[model samples]
Target chain A: MNSPLFFLSYFVLSALVLVTAMAAVSFRNLVHCGLSLAFAFLALGAFYILLGAEFLGFVQILVYVGAVAVLIMFVILLAKPGVEERRWGWRDLVGRFAGVGVSLAVFLALLISVFRSPSLAVKAPEAPVFSIAVLGEKLVTEYVLPLQATGLLLTVAVLAAVIFASQEVTKK
Target chain B: MLEDKSIYPDLREGRRVVRPGGKREAKPLNFPARRPWLTLGLAGAAGVFGALVGVAVLLFLMEWLKPGFLGEGCFLYAALADLDRAPAILLNGFLAYIASFVPVPPILLGILSALIVIGVLIGVFLSLFALTSVVERKVLARIQNRYGPNRVGPCGLLQPVADGVKMLVKEDIVPAGADRVVHFFAPVVMLVPALLVLAILPYGPGLVPMELSVGILFFFAMGATTEVAVFMAGWGSTNKYSLLGAMRAIAQMISYELPLIVSAVAVVMLAGSLSPEKIVETQAGYWAGIVPAWFVFTPWGFAGFLLFFIAAQAESNRSPFDLPEGESELVAGHLTEYSGFKYATFFIAEYVGLFAISGLAVTLFLGGWYAPSPLLAFIPGYIWFFVKLYSLVLLAIWIRGTVPRVRIDQLMEFAWKFLIPMSFVVVVAAAVWHYSGGGFLGWVVCTPLLLVPYLLFGSAFAKKFAPSGRVYRYSQG
Candidate 1:
């Protein structure tokens, strides 16, 4: 698991994720940005697969790359593609600085938590034999409340979306 | 006729006999026509002889290169000995044997074996694509009362090969204003997911290429990527027709994907595993040693299978749901700007996508590779899988010939108002069936649950969209 090849692949995937993420943010074309975001999502899924969470990895791809990225692309395409590009102004500069500061703060907090965690000091546990059945069981049994809550929230969101869409049609 | 050909009567007669104007008959090759059975026998004999000789030569070369390569206790020998897994075993064993001589790393060997599997899958499916292309045309021709392509080869069997050559030799024209990079990569992007989806399907016992834990999820994820590819193709083409087609495709795919995945969820729930191999295994065996215990035989399974099939049809953009590529309106839709090999690639991708989805339908509902009865169990599983697959493909072709292309609004309404709700019902009924122990009580509970919604949806849709008498506003009765 700790083979040099594994580390090499890990670093490569991380680099891919970072590069794609940067491209996603910086691409001039909205569609290109969406595609780069999808690539980033795909790279993240690969990272999860490397960590042996195959279910999570696949789900990540299914949801993010498949659904979310597609939805983003649809929005970009359907929107006014002829809109003139706006020149960077003082507001944009301030927004960029604020975004960087927030991201740095979040990253530092995560880094601190990881470095100070007792689990990091202890011997790493053996990787569990991963199975979809176990994940399903855990979701239903131990994490039932959280699962139900998430389901309820998603259902509500879907209902709200339907209602909103229907209202638009009715208004038309 | 004599008056018309006053100077060249003999030449005219020869022309009339040789080149008849209408409905020219396909001439059978002379060798086969002379001795049909003998020719067939010889062909079969030659094929077997060639295969055997090829294997013998390969083995001899291997042994000559390294003495005791096929000796007792060798892993290669052990693998090759398994006749049931002959194709896979031979390829893997040969690669492993070569690796053994080369001192390659274990990881490289693993990667090589994986590549071999992928290569084999691609080879098999690409040929299947070729065969399917011709088969589809022939089947469509039959449906439409036409001769189809009888000029290329015997019964136009080699039409795909000829088409491949034509596409290869033809000029690839890209629109001047098109995004060259995206335009170029779109077909490639479209093809990659179609092939990737093929990896997770359990074609037979131990025949899956990848066998990921979340195989079905992986399939859907790969499927989702195609939407982006379609969009790329449309946007990159810089053609209104292409953009419109791509948009329609994405919308249709997104709409149908819900029902498709939802219906599959029923099978996954009932099978109790996301892994296709496990799902197939769970569906093994027959009830009372007679009827195969395929999920499609059950009430929820039947409904789910119907929903899944319909959604899959839409997903693959077959007729009744092929609004994206509606020839009358879109002029090949997203494919308008593509030409030559690029167009051929898109065509291949479409068929391959159809095959993948149909293969999934087989895996989920038709019990993967299981035979219909214990009596038929002697046949290889992959044969059964392909038999079921080809039947579904034929069914698609039949529907394409029979059904008119659906309107965009009707397509959306069907997916959203009918298929999606019906699929949810399937999921619920599946749960009910499972909790009720999947026996007589389960059937009793699930049948009415499925039937009522199906009837309601069908009748309501018919009532809403029923053709009414036209009102003549200008005419005075």
Candidate 2:
């Protein structure tokens, strides 16, 4: 009785996610495809809540649902209109089937890998006193140097992103 | 306050200031002093009252006939056995509705009605503020030496109201190419999170409805919803700029959030609790006088506070960091395809976000609605909080009208390079400062010591700036 809500929510959320992921590849329209992907992200957030990964759930909602989905939408919107059409064919149908097949295969493999391991990992670790305060202490005391280095790493990445975006296109 | 130039201030004038277009089926956005929709309003009210009476009569009849339909095994059924009894559920519901309207006596009725009135007043305030786009534009206009929306009403006092009606009347167009369901839900998705954040905010002591122990956590939860909603709006629009806007939003939000949290960490450490009330109490007086114990007073706290402010601006997608809605770049970004009420929803969500973030900043750093000092303690908690928030909001608006939006790379660099590193330093400094029993003055003194290294090493960052310029020049199509 206690876990029934979670269980029901999990099944529903997982179905939504699976359908969306499948739709991402199956949809004839590219723009519709992006929307299905956004749906998958949203369902994943729901799944996070069901798993009791509250912080991760919010992070999922924030990063994937909010930022990433919004950005993707912007790119799709700004892209050239009337670029693609919904044309169905044996080739398209075959490719979609193949995509589904490959996805299923990979998913099964991942599931096997997870269960074959010593223990099934929960979504997030239960820190002893894990509020924002505890996270802060570890960030400074335990992981201070790596944390600083992450900043430097981010700086280099941003520099690199600029370089890639700016570099001239050359013939392959 | 600026004297309201609208016809509303002219109650004494008695000049029959009829709002043009007369009454309609729906309520106009304007809070009309004169009953514009008197007939419709009365009819609606009459219908509602009739329904309440009808419901109660039906409920009484049903209970008299069979008894166990609505309230199973309850005293209502037992009491109903005697023919005449106390109020039924329907009667109670009707009473609640009636009591909501009238001035109840000086008892529970009065108290309940007062609460309902206050809640409605707050709701109205929030809704009005949400639609205060005209004021923003006017202020921005004044800054730019132009009068905005003056043609709409008396200096455009009723501009937002007019705009609301326009939005209502406009065609709710759905692009044939777009995902209709996602498009429909997108604005709703965007609006819900912004509204929920308002719930956690301690408007003042004994003011907020839900005074949860983990108010900050609830805030964080709501904040995350904005990202998901933005994504939906972008993706549902089925456009390129929308996609780009979503990406920019994600990158910006995730990157800036690190510093935002880091800065907040210092506050949490100093306050030693997640509760907003506790944070305020801790900062009551700076060791019996001399200094303000607010986070802004500390060395690391200052650095953290600034970082937090910048990150908040980015988090809320405010200007300077508002790359998501770079109007010139993405043609209003994720909202390009949106129009009518849908567009209005997104617009409201953005401003509500601004208020929420500013409110959070005031709570965490500026001491959660507490007055500036003991000298000013006579000032109500909510007043100081609002003053701080409005000033912050003004700062945000000022920057919006003034600064050009940052390029994607520069925005990213600002977060990753400067904010990220600086936030960590602040965290460490706070921990060390705490260990040393560094009084409020220590935090005040150490802030400059923390920044001296930045002043010296800042010349190095100037060299890196040149490389980005060179890259852009080399890569231009």
Model 2 per-residue lDDT at B463: 65
lDDT of 1: 0.85
TM-score of each: 0.89, 0.64
The candidate that wins on lDDT is 1
Error of 2 at B328 (Å): 3.7
- Runs of candidate 1 with Cα error greater than 4 angstroms are A81-86, A90-124, A163-169, B1-46, B59-82, B99-102, B470-477
- Write out fnat for all predictions, comma-separated: 0.70, 0.42
- What's the lDDT for residue B172 in model 1? 99
Report lDDT (Cα) of residue A44, candidate 1: 99
TM-score, cand. 1:
0.89
Each model's backbone clash number = 0, 31
